[model samples]
Target: MSRKKYILIFFVIILLCLSLVSYSNTTIGRVLRFGPANANDYLEFPYHEISTTSTYFKFGEANLENIVKSRFYDVTYGNNQKVGDLDQFLEDTDTTSFIVIYKDNIIYEKYYNNYNRESIVTSFSISKSFTSALIGIAIDEGYIKSVYDPITDYLPELKKRDPRFSNIKIIDLLHMSSGVSYKEPPDDIYTYFAPDLRKLALEKTQVVEDPGNSFLYNNYNPLFLGMIIERSTGKTVSEYLEEKIWKPIGMEFDGSWSIDANDFEKMESGINCRAIDFAKFGRLYLRKGNWNGKQIISTGWSVASTAPYGPENNEYYPNIPIFKEYPGYYSLMWWGIRRDDKNYDFYAAGNHGQYIYVSPEKNLIIVRNGISYGKGMESEDMSWWPIIFYQFANQFPSE
Candidate 1:
């Protein structure tokens, strides 16, 4: 044999060895900060009755495939200029699906290379906001008494152990002001990847600030809230959500939940749904939890969740660390923005570019889904996409 051929074979053997080791070490499960068991092992909730039977919108017979492919609205001047150039945008950023909905109709929906509209995309932290909507529905149904009630009232297991949590109101969790000692932007990567996120969240031995006095963005707030919902309502968050929200809204696809080591739904980030289903959620919020005059989530609670409450005295929650430099607002699970002389725009955003942007004034909803696992700060900022989307919003000539 030739010496060159022998050297090439030796390099290939070494590469195979490294690949095998990497595959063996990596766990076969969804990545979570902390949890005892792999997420896939979690038990799924039984399918509930879909409320679409009585609703005017029919999914099974609709030409959904053709609808997604056709252009329903004229691109805005700004979007028009950038339409042909979106390849550069996608290349520069991690974008999976980009869609635009106007006046309860889909105008433009496109998936990335090797992706399609039917692909089930993970919502990351965007699921938190959806969970908030579920909580609102539970309140409307009288399953939950009120947001002011102590969490212990619903989940007695949390009482007496943590004094700070003793009086923590349900609203406080929604506001991300539970006074729990949590490090945002995570100081230690290993600690963030623990198996039991619930234990880590509540086990924080110290209370740095009084509950409701300060605002801190942490996953613990939502995860804890999910537990409270399940304990109070005697149903998993996914079960309650399907019955109360998804089925009613006529969501066409089945969504999955990310489970913890104990097989509990993570609730903070484990939501996965199709792009159209996500748009349906955006539309539901756009209608203030109403679908054709049917009250899905109480309109009053819907308004409250998206509206701001804080000492900042601003109509929207300010001082979120991720968007500190940017002019944005946080309300419950949604992010609000006030553009120059434009209407108040709010959205449900997740890490790595998952977004459900809604403009009530224009009756427009835009959903962008992406897979940005290790892109760092740029994914969190989402600075460029919003700017591009706002420009897209301007394209529709005012009626």
Candidate 2:
């Protein structure tokens, strides 16, 4: 063969090899980006170092079939008319998981093309609500003196350096009203995953406004709360939640949280869990913090965390905008909605479509998990689903 022909053939082979490698890496990164693609690769962390033993509650052995048959209600809307196709909705939004639990029973559970029930999907900011639940449980057990206590009480490191943080109450963290000037945008994902998230958060010492006066949904609020939990209990947030909440609930599988470079769990958006286990939490709140005859958390605290408490007279923080046409409010960590005269719903919603909707009146709980890639609060399509769920809630016969 001529020298020129040989050179051309060798160049073509090299290009083909480069393309194959690039495609493989891209595919792998996408798979590992969200839920667990393989069971063997699952990571486990400690759950007992964060809270008291009494705070945890174990589930009793019950018939799954019986629970589903008795507790579930067929929910349909618009005279059984089709508002939209479920397949089309999922495709348009790039949803990986969808779970609907009604009255403690699994109603509709599904996993998308690249996901499964065993996949430990990321909860995004839904982890914030879980972190808030831990704080509530800590309060109920006396580990936390009170939400009114200044964060400096637990995290003394901030006492002298940051006076604003010293006066900021723990409750303020729950409402995202700590007055920290950290704007959480979708492009700022690196801040949470950085080597030192606390240092990154604390770098912005200039408070734009006084704490408790205005509402700002900054990620620093939850990050600060996680630090408080750590300093108070001498354990990481993951360890605290595991000991206090996860194992006690008889979670079918183990869950995990992504740790920062300093090994601290990113309390703001580091939690990962199965859809069913997430439903267990919704069920816990539905039963008013009592599970299997054990008072895991104070019903009063649960009610307070999920209801509106800010200056806006709505359930959630007043600063955050509600979905278009949705009567949404921000509470301690929950989101509330005055759906209609007959329906009232509140939920723990995270970025990227992670939600746990609790309806006490109808004894219904709906869990939706998806991989939504977008900016803060703008990632998920909030409308239509809540409306559908509200309509479904009305399907049950009036008491």
Q: What is the overall TM-score of model 2 with all chains considered together? A: 0.74
- TM-scores of the candidates are 0.75, 0.74
Looking at candidate 2, what is the lDDT of residue 1? 100
Candidate 2, which ten residues in sequence have the lowest lDDT sum?
44-53
lDDT of each residue in 1-399, candidate 2, tens digit only: 999999999999988876665444232232334323222222432122222233433333333433333332343332353434555445555566766655455656667758887787767777788888889887876778999998888866676776767778898888877776664453144344345667756554445666777666677778777877887777778887877777676566677877664677776676777777788888878877777788777889877877644374343334333533556667787777765565467887766567788777777777777766312214233434555566656555543
Best by TM-score, which number? 1
Off by over 4 Å in 1: 1-84, 184-194, 202-206, 308-310, 313-326, 339-342, 373-382, 397-399
- Estimate the lDDT of model 1: 0.65
Runs in model 2 with CA error above 4 Å? 1-82, 184-187, 312-325, 339-343, 373-384
Local lDDT at 250 for model 1: 76
lDDT of 2 at 356: 80
